[model samples]
Target: MRSILIALPLLIAAPAWAQGDDSELWLTATGEVAVADKTSIELESINRFSDDSGGLYEIELAAGVKRSLGDGWYIGGGYVRVVNYSRGTVTRTEDRLRVQGGFSTDAGPFKLSGRLRLERRAASTGDEIGYRLRPNIKAALPLGKSDFRLFAAHESFLPLDDTDWGENAGHDRMRNSIGVSWKASKAISVEGGYLHQYRLPRNGRTSATDHALTFTLGVSL
Candidate 1:
């Protein structure tokens, strides 16, 4: 586990070592309130920055409920509101509905988890609807008897249905990240690390690569 944790950063950064890409930042804050031993209500907000990393160009607000189905399986459903700012103007707003299920297991000293999510997206301007699927996997290793954990994840977005105003059917985006999580207390934890995102072109546009710093704060109650 220790050796794997030490190698994760190098593995995550190797792909973009020679390529110059846009630098961005993302911060997400989340709070969870327990409804039962296996259920919780989740709330989160994500702020995204652009190349110069000056101000937020996008924001995502999300709320959801999740339940453990016994063993290492779980299910969840959620809603999201996305706001985008660009070119000195408010560009777009999106409403999203999502459903997800996943499973996790302990593998030696590491915990491995995988999830599949389906999303329906509606835009305010065009009103066109789009569907997408996101699949991701993560591995976590706890530093012995400590409050620190090392984790790495890779997530991919695949369009399911085409819409005039949204992503077309194909690969949409890929995000890979490696991070460390610190438990500040029983109810709070903080995570921050490097994330690499690759976006496929839409229509005739060029592909984009984003090298970003990802930060998150999680609170449990």
Candidate 2:
């Protein structure tokens, strides 16, 4: 446990070791409500600010529902509306539909989880539908008996189908984050982290990297 805790800071700082093209901030508010036994609904709002994109570059609003399948397994799906802005002007909008399933389990003092997501994305700038696959894993460890926990997560974006609006059918990008979560109360938690995003070079495009400070406020009811 001590070794793992020591490595968490390295994982968080690894992105900064690379040459990042942009600096950004991401803020998210998420809430979950139990509607039935073993079933819940989640709603999220995310706002992102970017330096190169002229600040306040993106906004996402999403809602989803999940049903626990017993013994640490679950399935869910949701819709997201994404709006892109440049220099405070709205540039494009996107609609995304997602279906996902995953599992979670505890290993000694560590909690591990993984999920796979399938997405269908449609953009206002193009008629071609884009299909994407995202797989992610996360691990968390409690800070002794305190209400704070340390966590690290990685997610990959793979484009399954090509589209005119810059979707190249291949490995697209990845996100890595390291952070700590605080249980502020029984129903509220807060998380703050450093997130690194790297986009693979494809279709004559140069690779891009983003360093972001991320914060999240989560509520459960």
Candidate 3:
């Protein structure tokens, strides 16, 4: 039998953009408890910047809208905030704003969706960055009593640490993951998988890498 363990992240990832006008409002509250092998990525000099970089626990609350256009394409925008209380001493608060465009359709028992994210972020260190997250494609399959899905995603993070000067930090990150989804019921779904993420090096340094086991829960409004 196929594993039902990998099911949450991909299911909720793009349903918000499956089609145009499918749902005007979307809401979901997911409480996930996981052990992060690494706390944070190492930037450059440690004395200049201090972060725990240890095991971590995270909780995320997300709510947004999925608007579909008359054509097969759709566009969506929303804000999600995450509060991280690390095992290490540092407490981090992250806020993200994204606008996404996608195309969706169904093939027999499965549905396919794709999206791109344009974003800006302000880090706790008071660094603001502009970047793009994309190639986030998902496919949902119906398997008799339950459902399944697959996701492929790549996210890039840019550094705007120096708005004061034209000199840029020139840093970006990329993440690649693959997982499966199980529709436990209308109200919830469970998913977990392996995520390979690497923080691109900047200013003559090596890259930081992480291979993490990710679990996500999906709920409906």
Q: Which residues of candidate 3, in runs, are more than 4 Å off?
A: 2-52, 57-60, 70-72, 84-88, 107-110, 127-135, 140-146, 150-153, 156-171
Candidate 2 colliding pairs: none
* Candidate 1 residue lDDT tens string, 1-221: 64465456656765674463677779999999999889999999999987644467899999999999998999999999999887446788999999999999999999899999999999877757999999999998998998778898999999987787857898988998898888889999988778888898887868888887788999999
lDDT of 3 at 76: 60
- Model 3 shows how many backbone clashes? 11
Candidate-wise lDDT, in order? 0.86, 0.91, 0.52
Q: State the lDDT at 85 in candidate 3.
A: 57
Overlapping backbone residue pairs in candidate 2 total 0
- Expressed as tens digits, the lDDT of each residue in 1-221 for candidate 3 is 56433445435434433432221111223532222321111111001111233344344444445555745676666666655554555576666676777788887766777777665554464555544444466666665664665555555555544542122445466766666666777767766655556777676656765555455565542
**Which residue window of length 10 is worst by lDDT in model 3?**
41-50
Q: What is the number of backbone collisions in each predicted candidate, taken in the order shown?
A: 0, 0, 11
The whole-model C-alpha lDDT of candidate 2 against the native structure comes to 0.91
Ranking by lDDT: 2, 1, 3
> Candidate 2 has what TM-score?
0.92
What does the lDDT read for residue 203 in candidate 1? 70
lDDT for model 3, please: 0.52
- lDDT of model 3, residue 90: 53
